[model samples]
Target: MAASPDTLARVEELTARRLNRTLLARQHLLARSTQTAHDLIHHLVAVQAQESNAPYISLWTRLEAFEKDDLTALLADRRAVRSSILRGTQHIATDDDYPWLRPTVQPVLDRGRQGAFGRVTAGVDPVELAALARKHLTGQTLTRPALARLLAERWPDVEPLALGWSAQCLLPVVHPPPSGTWGRFGATPFVLAEEWLGRPMAAPDAERLVVRYLAAFGPGSARDVQAWSGLTRLREVLERLPLRRYRTPAGVVLYDLPDAPLADEDAPAPVRLVPEFDNLLLAHADRTRVIADAHRRVVITGAVVRPTFLVDGFVRGMWSMTGAGIVLAPFEAITEAARDALTREAAELLRFAGTEGSVSFTAPGH
Candidate 1:
C-alpha cells in the first residue's frame, strides 16, 4: 500500500550524489546482477535498443555472466520483443511487459505518428489504415518498405512512407529477431504485437507504470516520469498515489517507492562502460544526477547520445570500439586510478565483444 500525500509533508531531501548512487544501484551498475537477461529486462521494464548492439552491451555491463546468446534465445523463443515504447523509441522489453507497457505508452506513439505523418496522411482515415495494416501484418512479418508498398495498393495518392509510419505508430507492432540481435542490421521488419506474442495488449495502467518507473528510475520528479514516458499531465497521477517524497537540494520534489532503498552517497561506485542510448542517461528529466551539463552537450549531439563511461557514478567520457579494440575518449582528464579501472573494464568488454586488440585513449574532445 502507498502512504497518503499528507504523510509526505516531512519528506527527506537528497543530494545529487545520493541520487546518482541510487540510480546506479537500481540499474545494477554498482555491481553486476546474477539474474538472467530475461529477468533483467523485466526489472528494467525495457532497455533502449535503437542500435543493434546497444542491448547486448547494456546487458554485458550490468549482468554477472551475460552471453550474446542469452538475449538471442529470448527473442528466438518469443519470450521478449523489440518495439517502440516509452517516448516512441526502440526498446527491448519482455513479452509480459509489452502488452501493458505498449498500451501505457501508446500516446507517445500516437503523437509521434501525427507529428511525422499526419500531413501526408491528412485525407486517410486512421481507422481504415490501421485495419488494412492489420490485415497485411496479422499472420506474417513485412519490412517497413514492403509494408509501405502494400499500403500504397489502397492509397496510391498518399505517401507510402507516411502510410507505413502511420501503421507502425497506430498499431501495436514489434520488430522480430535478427532485427534487434547483435551484429545484425537490416531493414526493420514489423509484426503485430498480438499475433507475435499470441496475446492481446492490456489496457493502460498509469498507476502501475508510475510504480514501475519509481522502482527502476525513481527518487525522481513528475517531470522525470513524463520525460521518460513522453506523456503529459502525470502530476495528477503522482499526487493520488501513496508515495514517499523527497526533495532535491534545489527543491525539486522527487518520488520513490516507500520501501525502495536509497544508496549511501559515499558508497563506492565502479567504473562502467555503458552503451549508446542507455536509459541511465535518458531516464530522468534532469540528468545532472548522472551527467554534468557540460558533458551532456558533448555526449549528446542532436539525435545521437554517444556511449559513455562512468567514473564515481557520473559520466566522465565517451567510448567506442575499434577494429583493434576499445577506444576511450574522456571529456576531461581522469585520475590514474580511474584510467587503470577503465582499461581493465575495456579489456573485459573486448572479450565479451569477441574482438581482439588493446585499449587505447584519445585526447580529450576527440
Candidate 2:
C-alpha cells in the first residue's frame, strides 16, 4: 500500500523532535524497541562519551547538561573508542561495539587504498609494509609522519602522505593520544587497534548494523542507510529485515522497525543549532526529513558544510559568530516566532562560548 502523505508528514514531525534533541537522544533509545528522540540522544551521548570531551560538547548543544568531562571519564574507562566508522571517518563508539563496527567499515578503507593509495604504493609489499609499521609502533606511539618516515625508508617509492593514509586505512590501527587527549597538544599517533583495545576487529555483519541504523534513524529509505554508512546494496539487507515500509510524498519508499515511533506531524519544535558534521544533516539520502533543497546552498557550499539552524524542522538558514557578534543569514524569510526562538538559541550559544555575543539577521533579498 502507498503510505499516506499525512502519515509521512507525521513521521517527519516526530523524527525531527527526536533528532532535534541531538546525539544524546539518538544513542539512548537505539537499543530499545520504542524509543523517543530524547532517549536516542541520551544513548548517542553515552556512546559518544566513550571519547569524552568533544562528545560532551557534541551533546551539550543538543542536550541540557552535558559536561566537558562527562565524555572524558568514559574514554578513561575504556568503555568507548575513537576510530573510523561508516565512510571511514572517525567516530567515538563503544569498545565492545568497535570490534564489529571497524571490520564492517574495512571495505571503505580497502577500496580507498586500492584506488587512491595503490597508485602510490604500487610496488610496495603489503606484508612487508605492515610488518614495518608493526615494528615501528610496537610499545611506542608514532605520529603519522614518524610512521611515514619509518616506512619511507623501506618503500621509498611511496609518497609519505599516501603511506600514512594506507597505513591507517589498509591496516587495523588506532590513533592514540595526544590526538584526542583533553586539551593536550600533539599529533595523531598510530597504534594497533587490537593492542590498544585488547581485542581484534570483529567480523562484518551488514544486516545487523543496517537494522541498528534503521532503529535509530528509521522510517527512512534504504538509500538513507547507504548515505549514512557509505555502504551499497543495502536494499537486500532491508528487504530481509522484518521492517514496515512506507513511501514519502516523493514516492521514495522507506523502512523502519515495525514498532518505532514516528514523530507527531504537528509537534512543536525548538530552534536548534547543530554542530559541524552533526549526523542530523548527513543521515539521509533525501534530507527533506529536516531541510529543504533550496536552503541546501546555505548550509553546504562545495565541500564545506556550515553549522545550521532548524526552525520548525526545516533549515531556515546558516549562522556564524565572530568578533562582531552572531550573524544569521536566512535562505528564506523566517517568521517572528522563528526569529524569537533563534534569538534565544543564539543567546544560549553565546553563553556557551563564554561571552555575550550580539545577534544579526540577513535575509536573502534584502
Candidate 3:
C-alpha cells in the first residue's frame, strides 16, 4: 500500500533518530570495539591548540581505565609525538601514523602559509629552511625565537613567530617534554618528528586514511569528515567507497560505513562534560546531529567554545564552577527534571575538576 506524505515524513524522522543513537553506541564500543586501550590510543587522540591535557579527557571517556601516564609514556617512547595534524591543530599521533596523516593535512598548513607567511618567506627556499630546522633541532631543543635566530643568519627579515609556526606546522616537529608535563613550566621547545619518532613520515594514502577516520568518527557526512581531518578533498575520495547514505532533516546527506550502528534521537543521553575542542562537538561541519542549531552560539563564541554540559543528547546550557560550586546557565528554559540531571552532571564535572558542591547560576545577563 502507498504511504501518505505525513507517514513518509514520520518514517524519515524515525530513521534519523534511530541512526543517531546507533552511531553513539558504536563509538561507545569503539574502544572495546577494537582490542586494547593501547591499540585505541594509537589512533584516538583528538587535536587541540594550547591545552596539553585536553586529549586526556577525550580518551578517558572513550576508553576504560585510561591514565594520564599512558599517554605520557607514548610520548616518551616515541610511539606518539605532539604536533599539528588534523584541522592543522596540535594532536598526539602515533609515530607510525604521523607520516601519512601529517602530509594529508599539509595542505591546510600550505594554505595558511600562502595566506600569511608565504610572502614573508617568499625569497627563501623551503628545502633550505627545512634543513636549517632539522640541523638546529637535531641534537637539541630551542624555543621559537632561539630557532628563528639560527635562521636569521640566512633569512634576516622573517618574523620569528611566523617562521616558527611555519616550521612547526609545515614540518614534522614535536614540542618535547616539560611542555606537556602536568606541573612543568617555561616556554615550550620543539624536536623534529622523524628524530623523535625514529623514522620519516609516510606519503599520503587517501583511501587508508579515510577508512581510519570512518572507524574513529564515522557515520558522518563528507563535510563532517573534512572538518575533522582538515582535508577538503574527502568528498571525491568518500564517494568512491561503498557507504550507506541517509538524508538529514536539514537537507544534508549523511554517509557512513554500511554496517555501523545508529543511535535513537530519543535516547536518554546522560549529562556529560566534554572538553574544549572535543571531537564530539568539533568533528562535524553541521553539528545538529549532537548539538541543536539555536544553542550553537552558547557553546561556541568566535574561536573559543566553552567545554559544555550535555543533557539528553542536547546541549541544554553552559557550565563552570567557581570556588563555590558548579554553575549551569541554560540557553533556553529546560524542564525541572533536566535541571536536576544537569545539576548532577555539574557535580560530576566539579569532581573531575577537583572541586566541591556545584554553584548556583547567576541571573541572566548579570
* RMSD (CA, Å), each prediction: 2.3, 5.3, 4.7
Cα lDDT tens digits for candidate 1, 107-147:
89989998988888999999999999999987899999999
Runs in model 3 deviating more than 4 A are: 1-16, 29-37, 43-49, 183-186, 321-325, 353-366
Error of 2 at 191 (Å): 2.4
RMSD of 2: 5.3
TM-score of each: 0.97, 0.82, 0.84
Relative to the true structure, candidate 2 reaches a TM of: 0.82
Error of 1 at 27 (Å): 0.4
Whole-model Cα lDDT of every candidate shown, in order: 0.92, 0.66, 0.67
> Tens digit of lDDT per residue, candidate 2, span 1-366?
445676665543334434433322342311122432234343442222223233444555655554445555555655665666666666667666677877887888777678877876889877777777887877777888888988888878778888877888766776664467455545576778788888877789998787778666666777898887877888888888888766654557778778766554555566777655666667787776677776765577774567677776667777877776788777778889888878887887776655566988987533
Q: Judge candidate 1 against the unseen true structure and give its global Cα lDDT, from 0 to 1.
A: 0.92
Angstrom error of the Cα, residue 163, model 1: value is 0.9
Top TM-score model: 1
Off by over 4 Å in 2: 1-57, 181-186, 323-325, 363-366
